[model samples]
Target: MKDAPLTPPLCSTDAVLATLPAGAGDLPGAMIVWEGALYIGTAPGAGEGGHARILRLPWPGGGAVEPVYEGPEGSAVTGFAALDGSSDAGPALYAALAAPGGGLILQAKAGAGAFAPVTEPGLGEAARRWIGPLALWGGRLVAAAGRAAPLVGAIGSAELLIEADDGSGTWAALSEPGFGDPGNVAISLLTVLDGTLLAGTVNPARGFQLWQAGEDGAWEQRIVDGAHRHVASPALTACAAGEGELLLGSGGAAPTAADLPADAQPPELLGLDPATGWELIAGEPRFTPEGFKVPAALEGPGFGWVKTARICAILRDGATITAVLAATPQSARPFGLPEPGAARIWRSEDAGETFVEAAALPHPLVAAAAFDEGLLLAGLAGGKVRLRVAT
Candidate 1:
């Protein structure tokens, strides 16, 4: 595909509207867009105890980001899901909290005072390391938990908990031995497509693979085999069924001493057909130049590579996807470091075919969500947040 000129005015960049009030020290964990508001969760920052809190930013911009729930100190929120209430249940938000002792999944209704913990029935005292990438599929809340056991080694596993309208749920393991080795991989992303739950993992031997769980609770896995023995991790998002594709961002495996002179391998973005157990449909060119270290979100026109200072976050608006590129420069060569880098917005409307420079941003963007009014809510490094609307 022919590359588009790095043009300007395809998008706009705005200033920081709200700086999340950092308690003594806090690290932003997860940010999501739901119900016309921006929800942010913070983990413990430097010198601060690990305390988890949920902050809500109302719509229409220019408002205070307040903490709705302040949990015990040292508790970290790793995942979040917005739940639409059923006949017996009311609208609520589901969150996964990772504490030092163990992890717990809690549900908080819209009007309810506080969140109530949902116990994982039949799950005994299993070790929980990280709780995240939560998904709500077919009346069940699914999440990945890294279990650390003395003899079993570290295993990345998934659990499906029955989410009843009455706030009662039951849990079952989705990663059992016979199917295949769960290995010691981390489940980075999870999504529900066409009544099936899809999970992306970074495993030891397989590099990256997409695992699917059907409505009947059966699981199947498909490895995204790349040319020249490459490692890939699947990142999934829900679009218009056929248009929705799985993104395999490159990372994890680094070149060894013997492979120094060799060129750094770029990551491949593979499109999957969800119904057929993640069948590889098409493979796009490795968007980010090789050896760039961490290649962040594939944003803008969705086609070509938008080399940024440091990729902070990626947001898609209509057919265009905007990449929040940070301005961090590196001294290392072979990584294709940006020259005179600064934070800016790069957009692509052709599905990774081409890209153009959009707008200049103040801080490094970490996360962004497209709002209904054509506005983009962006979370930046150092607890800064901004809103970028169409010019």
Candidate 2:
């Protein structure tokens, strides 16, 4: 019946598959399609303050865009996780460097060489500056240290829950720092549903907190007051579709279109149904704790776009699951399109209930991966530039 509206692919710039350099940023920063190639990862952007690199596109797309690993000019490259190694360590690829003496977690072995560090920066404290969304679940590797750059404004600390497990790169501190709430500084995001392992925090005073990781690993809070909305001031992007479902979104703040509607504040997408928990597949609804929800996503929330609200990427594809849109990218170059605003994409098929807007990209896409046979987009950025990084 309604199967005719699925033709949206050219993604702009001839389906760009490589564009990394010039600060490595456009918002989201961590794509993953290893070995054959496709490993972005960026954080610092906005001129002279951009260097957190890690590029290498070559798979299911075109090719020629290699940097591999570069962090250290101001460092960036927030998070990325991949580990099957299959033994003799034939598959590694783990990154999470926010640089400056309090963050690191490199390690890339089995083909696209060179990425060492293993642990030792923030794991040793140095202040726990920033480490990120890395998740693996029961086997190990579950990072989420503290403090981040949701654009530009970083200064909250203590948000642990960092683990590692035998690969020996050594990392431990399963949470005690902020979980004790130092205003719960940061845990940004981590995923894994169906085997359990969830965490999302960022507490700007009070807002954003979703924790669950048991079986003796201990950590159960699951959607505290923030889910009620402090503007979702913590939780960043997350994804764990299929089987019990899980997909939370929102970013405390810093996603402005010059203060849209008068003070910015619109970027939501929460839905966790372990049985009947938080609902509202998109933004703007009310009452939660499992009562009144009312938003099955009808082009609302950030989908009602204006930029940021923090969600740069959350794709699934197969059963359709996409949500990529972030602000602060005024592309005039660096792979094309995105000049005044335009880089949409939202899809959900029978899983999240409803959603459709598929493609509008010209870049500013942020991060996506599923390569080989198809799919490897990146940060095509958005429109409107001319600030020169003073934010």
What is candidate 1's TM-score against the reference? Answer: 0.70
Residue-by-residue lDDT tens digits, candidate 1, 354-388: 55667654443334433444434343434433344
Q: In model 2, which regions exceed 4 Å deviation?
A: 1-39, 42-53, 56-66, 70-104, 107-114, 119-169, 173-198, 201-209, 212-287, 290-310, 313-342, 345-360, 363-391
Q: Global CA lDDT of candidate 1, please?
A: 0.48
Q: What local distance difference test score does each model get?
A: 0.48, 0.60
Give the clash total for candidate 2: 11
- Candidate 2 lands at a TM-score of 0.31
lDDT of 1 at 389: 44
Q: What is the lDDT of candidate 2?
A: 0.60
lDDT of 2 by residue, 1-391 (tens): 1111213642322444434444344333566776777666665544436667776656654467677677776767777888876645557888888766778888888774778777788777766657776877666677877655443454665455556555656677777766787666667677778887777776665677788778886788878756777744455554546555676667434322221122335567776887768776777667765677777765567766655445545555456566655453443235644444344556677655787766654434444433324344453333321101000
Worst 10 residues of 2 by lDDT: 382-391
